[model samples]
Target: MEPRCHSWTHWADEVVLMSDTTSRLLIEDARKALVRRLVSVCGQRDLIEAYVGWILGDKTKEFVDFEAAALASKLRISEPGRTYRDVAVLGFAEHLSPHLDTLYALRKGLDWMLGRRPFLPNREPDFEVDGIALLGMAVGILASGEWEKRKESEKWFIALLAETLRRSRFELWDRSLIYAAQLLITKESTAEREITPDLALALAAKGFISVKEDYERKALELIVNQPNYAEQQVDVVATRLAALNWLMRQVPTVLPNRAAPEDVINLLERVRDSLRRWCWEEKPRVRKAEAVPVKWEILNEYHVQDLLWVILAPIFPDLEDEENLPSLGHKHPRCDLGIPSLRLIIEVKFIYNGTSSEFSRIIEEVASDASLYLSNDSGYDKIIVFVWDNSRRIEQHGELRQGLKKLQGVREAIVVPRPGKMRA
Candidate 1:
């Protein structure tokens, strides 16, 4: 029989069609019809029986009734209740009923097992939705439209599985709840973005993650998929951080703080440090000082501060009387090598074409406020500059080129180009 859902405008086609149509008709009668059509009629019996009790009685949920267990037993094993419930479900599927609870349960049960949790043996005799079928069903259930019963079922399952998997490898969530979560991951809409960094950081405090290390790792993975899952990510990572931080505080179980590999940290830092260059170069250099020898003389960026001072001393050869000028010194904060009066700070940056804006921001922040990089501007005659690899900057508007820009207070600025390495 064709599914009623196909003809019915507002129902799952398979659901409405796989119903148990046995009242005026007999199971024998329906079987013959299906066999003639070459349909296996698999699981149709249970499907039809489940919804039949209600469909015959005004389509209300009140149809979920049961006779006395003692009386039901004498009538034969096909009587109502869980024992012969499978038959009704199969019948419903065969006739293509708009109702389907057995399928939902089967999908949920399979999900619990898939998460590698300890589960009570599903006593139901197996049919189509088993193993691979279960996984496939889970994906469908998750991706399906709004389902209230599904959510409620998932919550109960999660709570139950928590107890079941408490002593198992699936301890992250209750064994019962694993299906619920899988449903969420699978069924949740991709368009509704809610992930964020603050959320990811907070998951450590919430106890969802036992170790900060594990939390960070998983958070990154989750972010790749859900960049905007602000709330859940925070709650999850916060839990992990809380657990990991607690473990760290205990003197005996002490592990190194943030055990992420140094190489990884260095690589990440280099990437971030690279962004500073991008922020600039997109905008024309607004001059705050005279355009001195724009290029700084540097053998390499290793001793960038030393190289900046070396380049500047010749450009602005010191006046004999002005011993109170900002001098070059490695200990100074801003110049990183310049003295009080002779301030000359320079960062060895590898500026890329795409990253000029980012670099501009970093350099601007450092340069805009002299106090930030240089302490006393007694004779702060020069502004610090950092140019990495590429110095050929093209800044223009229409057919006009804005003249070289300058920073206030500083007499001139120099650009130190790092050699060899090139950016595409």
Candidate 2:
């Protein structure tokens, strides 16, 4: 019987290993297919060829020089056939080139272009109306890093991109382009909290799978089946490729190993368990002349929140404390702690005593907070309530937790008793 059990366990382990291998192979295949598609599309247009080369770091000096020469000729002749929009694309491509001379020329060209239509905050710029041009200029400015040189041309370009992202509708492809540029500039810190969900929705609308789930596979699909070679389609495909590459390098995979809502609940349970053994006694000690115990205690909701924040910060770098929720009607609600990346809000409750009245009030307060928070545009999808019951009412905890769980958006409720021997 022992031999048979060992054989069965070994067989299960092999099966699990094989499953993981298969999944990895599928992911690799999907990535390769996307790269192949991108390469094929890059051949269709010079602008895309240059832009993608810059994005993928496949730029060749010979090709950059040739592209630069062509753009310079167009600018010099003031090509009757070329509109200012075309000049913007040329400027974008020129910036992607490695030549210093081309960059200087491109700066002058941008100055002329801006003279035609200066940056006006209130008025919509022509580039904003033209998604391809907008992205072209934005990407060009970023690739050149001229904005760092304190150049007015690049500064204006940055301002334009920032305003475009701020003002554009989330549903529009323009917003996605500007958001992608923003991501490239900030390297995924500044705008991620606000734009990620909207970007996912936009990608979904384009028939790509949710960016939150299986983005690599869906992004491959979007690139391979890029319906047309129209300028707008090219811009969209290019933006998607750039965004995908950035995600692959800088962002963690949202796959089989990504943390889920359940993992957060488990973490909270661990936190609660750790708090059980908190301090030498009910209060923390200071090793002065002797081990002097301070009167510091988890006295209120803020105290509970601060303790939780210290424990959670090392784990979640993006954790926010006292994050304000959108105002609903006349009431302004604030979350005790929020993990933006997880879209999880944590509300800490401190019950002075585990009395029935106190428990009832917690239920009502949690319920009210839930309605306001979940219904807001704050982007949090779930809530976890952490309750510190100082009254040691372990009996009422089960009922209180159950009642809190029933509230909408309350993913889990944790009730932790004050450590034994701690003065209430």
Candidate 3:
């Protein structure tokens, strides 16, 4: 019996060893294949960069800049209002002598890959090369082509991302991929608008080219795991609050007279508008210092309240001097903004994502808080719910607006600044 047991154990160990060995062999095979593919592309690996450098004669300017400068020079040198044919002859790409055919092919491949085809100057290409050589060259050309088209607006997003990477502690590969994906998605959009993961996924659904998968996956991963950029700005917040407190104390008589409840509601709207504008700024303030700002994944309800109290309280007189009015009923309810004269309470909810479940949760919390504030009868008259949809998560907040309208004392359900439009 002992011998049989030992033999069975030995057999199991052998099986485990075989599995490990098989996995290692497979990994090695994949590594070898990747190496061979890379080797095949070695000859033309730097061709695009070299060609661009040669054409520009300066390493500082990007390919797009070179193209733009060349085109502008052609326009200057050409006869006034030349025909389309004459203009074509003066094109930047037309003047390039080295591998002109290859450059054209590169641009064509880029257009095809970027979903820019079926537009203008479309061409047919010979399927000449395979493996990494073709793909490697194609990738560089695509980047240059996309940049040429999107350089103006795309820089803001890139610079923003670069600044964020400099400020944060994200890994090297993670930051690089994140920056690349952001640049790609920004170029993909027709409006030249900011991008999110869901937008990237939607763009992918609309049929982007081969490399789209890599970028889409990276963008999605980034959205899911976007680092929490909101560091506690204790010193800054405290300083600002102290300044506000002092200013408020000095001008106690300047508090706006308590008017109808509608006035308070309007005040909340203004606050919401201010926050939305701040959120959409080219360099959204993630930290106290405005030097290196980032957008999204940072400001929370507390930050919103802090900002509101400081900004709104000064203008609106009826706003309570105290911060975070305590509710007598349940421990869960807290008033972020309170109006003593009108008995109005304003709650700000920051929208993070567009998921139905997330929206549902937000709705549930608002409803519960509304019930709590009204339940206490501690002079709280109306609850104005401000949903800060910075991410444009609440697309068509009609249903949400309607649902919030049904809640008791909920005067207005405002999705701040509405989506896509912000006051500059």
Candidate 4:
């Protein structure tokens, strides 16, 4: 036989054709019959039952009718009365009810769980909302193989489990253990998230292989084998920095101090040393009886900034390089390296072939850079100049250093060895 309320559209149209009083009476009667039939139906019924019950005067039997033992036996509840099974039922009803708003139902359901409302349905709920909500959340957990998405449900379940355990007082075969286990295993069909004592003990009993080492090995393989980029011109240093940062984040537990500035600098120095040791172009040898002068390969300020980025990323993920100085009511100067967290500013200067003009210009530039850095209200505590003397031409280095030190906010100036100098 065809279901009477199967075609809601036809029913709705027929209702509209009836007189107002007659239509209201018909709707009220149909709702009453639906609610009565719902109580009799068994084995995973729709959440629509709750919506219908609420609409048809939300009247239902109270827990007084249910003997805890009988209820436990019938529903296979391991520990009866230990959990707010009614809340789970309501949440399920809300989730599945087309007529009920999801969030509204959730709020109402949570209110019952939190004891804000002393009772749900003004008595015994038509269905266990809490159980069904947990079951549904378990389905999500199993499908995603993650615990975070079901965080709200998990939190409630843990609290419920805790309360049940407390009431049972850790007794063997108690309702608390049974209820908690049932909730955990509710919808876990494949046993993917099963936390049984046997399984835990079995895992602990076995000798486990180091999976992390294998994962790292594969990662290293990819890093070494893969080209920097498949297409277009990509900066090699930038690519290397990105790969290194990814490795750090992926295995943060293995790293000494993840995201610490000094730790980042240490990592950077390792890369810098490797690059200086192997990546630089070597000078050509002169033939016998031939006089040929060889100039050292010099790296510009921008290239040096890229090298700084390799070390800075682990500590200061937000560290800015070549950032434009804030317009502090003067000509806007650009920073070579600026660590906002440390309030530290670094200016990099490289003198090529050390001519008198070049020497004078770079010295003046460092002094001006210090002046600009100090004048700005960027709240920088220290400014340091790193000068790479490629030509080794500066005589009386102490006097030149003193001149730079005289500038306001200027800290100690240091001359760094070039890659070519290190090669020698």
Top of the candidates by TM-score = 2
- lDDT string for model 4 (48-88, tens) is 23322221211223211122222232232223343344444
Model 3 ranges with Cα > 4 A deviation: 1-258, 271-298, 321-332, 417-424
The local lDDT score (0 to 100) that residue 317 gets in candidate 4 is 45
Per-prediction backbone clash count: 108, 0, 1, 10
Better of 3 and 4 by lDDT: 3
lDDT of 3 at 341: 39
lDDT of 3 by residue, 135-248 (tens): 222223322332353343234334443444344443333232343344443444422222333333322221221223333333323322323313312211121222222222
TM-score of each: 0.20, 0.47, 0.34, 0.32
Tens-digit lDDT string for candidate 1 (1-424): 1111211133222221112463213323432332222222112323222333212222212222212211222232233343323332332221122233233333333333334333447843232212212222333333222344446534543454334324333222222123323333333322112222223233222211122343343432332233232333222322232222332222111222322222222322343245333322323365666533232333334544353344444433221111222212212122333322123323333334425564555446545445433332222334433433344443311111111124443432333233323332
lDDT of 2 by residue, 1-424 (tens): 0111111122221111213566546445544544545545533334455444443332233223336433543456254554455545554554334342345444444555566554466875666555555555554443343233426655565666666555545444545455555553444544433333324433332222225544434443444334443433433444454544433332223334555667768877887567556664533455567656655577788888888887777666556787655444335567889765567889999888567888999999999888877752345778999998888889998899899999999999998888775765
Flag regions of model 4 displaced more than 4 Å.
1-276, 281-297, 394-397, 421-424
Best by lDDT: 2
Ranking by TM-score: 2, 3, 4, 1
Instruction: Please give the lDDT score at residue 218 for candidate 4.
Output: 36
